[model samples]
Target chain A: MSVSIDARGPRWSAAITAVVLATALVTSNLWVIAFQAVVFAIGAIRGPQFTPYALIFKKLIKPRLKSEPILEDVRPPQFSQAVGLVFALVAVIASITGAGGVFTIAVGFALAAAFLNAAFNFCLGCQMYLLILRVRTAK
Target chain B: MPDVHYAHIDAESHLELVRKLDIRSTPTTLFLNSAGVEVGRAMGTPKRAQVQAAIAAIH
Candidate 1:
């Protein structure tokens, strides 16, 4: 089933993600990364609407909005959260294993994706979803 | 120097091609032999020396 939501919600969530991830990177804090992982896990499994950042956007930011946002399908953002979860999981594992290089790389990728969405409204994971769809249909 | 051919695919425009190639990230460089079989691949930004080494190995 498709669920429609304000497109700006995910973007707002992405802005928070970018900030959280950047802070994690700067501080080299595994706990912060772990926290972000939980957020991603909730978004991926339950839906983006259930994410903490999304809730913040809905409760604190939505009411102050000046205009209505374009509605979009929730599936893509959910998929994007799943992608973030994978990266977060990898970062967590690397941190636990003491693989500093792997942890940094995983977090770096996740940060880049989040920054792209927050700054440019470009959802890399959503693009990947569309590409996968095209590939499946082409076969 | 061996003869080498170069081709570029804009991943943003060619979604199907990008999917077909299983490219997960950008700035990915794939080296293929004359028979069109993939010989080597470099993901992310690679140094020029590294790229030359990869090409030489594939050659």
Candidate 2:
């Protein structure tokens, strides 16, 4: 049986959210960014259907799209979100400890990944997820 | 518009195909033609025009 993925919504909303999350790092907003990371984690584990971005898309963007969305793997994107969650945790830790170096690296890396996905249509987290899978299978 | 054939794989569930295709990330796209040959791809999330061009190339 095929997994019934909701392919109707705007995929870019996640990227935009990431962009905003990236801003948290710039403005040095820890709790706000931490909250964002948790939200993304919830969205990943629970499903994008529960995401505010998805809701926005469903309400605003999805209606305007002229073509049906191309269905793709649900797991990778979720996994990517999970990866995002981990980075968010790192960001939180870095923030709380006043580890500006780590905070920059962690949040910066996440922001870059998100921005790349949004702007260039490339997902660094997805690659990392696949690599993890390969390692798991190999062992 | 709705005549295209597409399938979304759960990368976690289907590790084999992912490895076979060397798929590294989400929003990765594959454009297959009538004979089941990949014509184009826009990894992450492709623009509408890009996908349309891929479709057109196959036809």
Candidate 3:
């Protein structure tokens, strides 16, 4: 029962939204960005912690409360988030430098990695946390 | 052994609670005795054995 996480739908939806938003940002598609921004704003305004897909999922499905280790609550540094931030910043700089294609590709890769993580739930950022722990403990 | 009942407090609420409890970081396990007095605490993913040892000491 514990292993049967009904997170499939939420995870996939989140992945799709992430991919679409990242692609739009990378490609500089104002329409797509605007659409996603509207959705994100609506969700955030609803509950402050309301993610777009989480809002939808919570509306349609109820989560079965069960006691589990709070490990998921551990907010260690997220590598994907860092990578996304860096890519977004670099993309802006690259646009100024007229290297749009390379910037778009870098953003695409970051978004793809995120989507891959959704499918696998094996976060590169979580791995970074493990690596940092290992290094700190080694010394 | 203290039954570790985890609570998912939001960042803002967590700040308030931590301020009151004097906890500073995540993975902060509060060990309470049967009388609900705090006996020990650990931060950041202390090994299960370490937690058990702490719990055993309290017991």
Candidate 4:
């Protein structure tokens, strides 16, 4: 069966990620960043509804919105979460390995994608997901 | 621009479109004419002015 999405879930997830990541970046707290990354990975692997941000939105934010909600396929955004997980993992590894540049770059990349989603409703990871599928199916 | 329209294709069900369009990058935009002919394309994150110009030239 196809997944029913409220669309707002992913946007809120992105917003939460952006805020948490920004905090991590500013505070230089590897532990907090690691927690954030793990949360992102879990969300991607399972579903946005399982994410903390989604839960918060469902409880506090969704009730306030008056516009009609819409649903879309889950695969694309799910794939985006996977992409996010990868970046977050990369940052985690970089921090553990003492590679500051790599950590910054990884977190920065993830932040940019999340920011795009929260601000413009665009998914760069979804675009990459399409390319990967194309390559896998090409032969 | 009246006839201009766009779509957001994902990797799950629309893999065929992704392949057919040769989409190797994110934030790609394709400009097609009324006949569904591809006349222009962009492969990276483009600015608003660039998109505006592309849509303005759409036929």
Query: Which model scores highest in TM-score?
Result: 4
Report how far residue A56 has shifted in candidate 3, in Å. Answer: 3.6
Least accurate 10 contiguous residues by lDDT in model 3 chain A: A1-10
DockQ-based class of model 1: incorrect
Error of 2 at A35 (Å): 2.3
Docking class of 2: acceptable
lDDT of 2 by residue, B1-59 (tens): 67698886666667787778877666578999878888777876688799889888887
Which candidate model has the greater DockQ, 2 or 3? 2
TM-score of each: 0.69, 0.71, 0.44, 0.72
Q: Which stretches of candidate 3 lie over 4 Å from their true place?
A: A1-14, A25-50, A61-71, A76-79, A136-138, B1-59
Error of 3 at A117 (Å): 1.7
Off by over 4 Å in 4: B1-59
What is the Cα-based TM-score of model 2? 0.71
| Per-prediction CA RMSD (Å) | 13.0, 4.5, 9.4, 5.6
* Lowest lDDT 10-residue stretch of candidate 2 chain B: B8-17
Over A1-139, each residue of candidate 4 has an lDDT whose tens digit, in order, gives 4576787788888988898888777766789789887787877888767888888989999999997786656666788888888888888888898889888888888889999999988778766676677778877
lDDT of 1 by residue, A2-106 (tens): 676787898899999999988888877889999999999999999998899999999999999997676666767889999999999999998888889988889
**DockQ-sorted candidate list, best first:** 2, 4, 1, 3
Question: Of 2 and 3, which scores higher on TM-score?
Answer: 2
Error of 1 at A98 (Å): 0.8
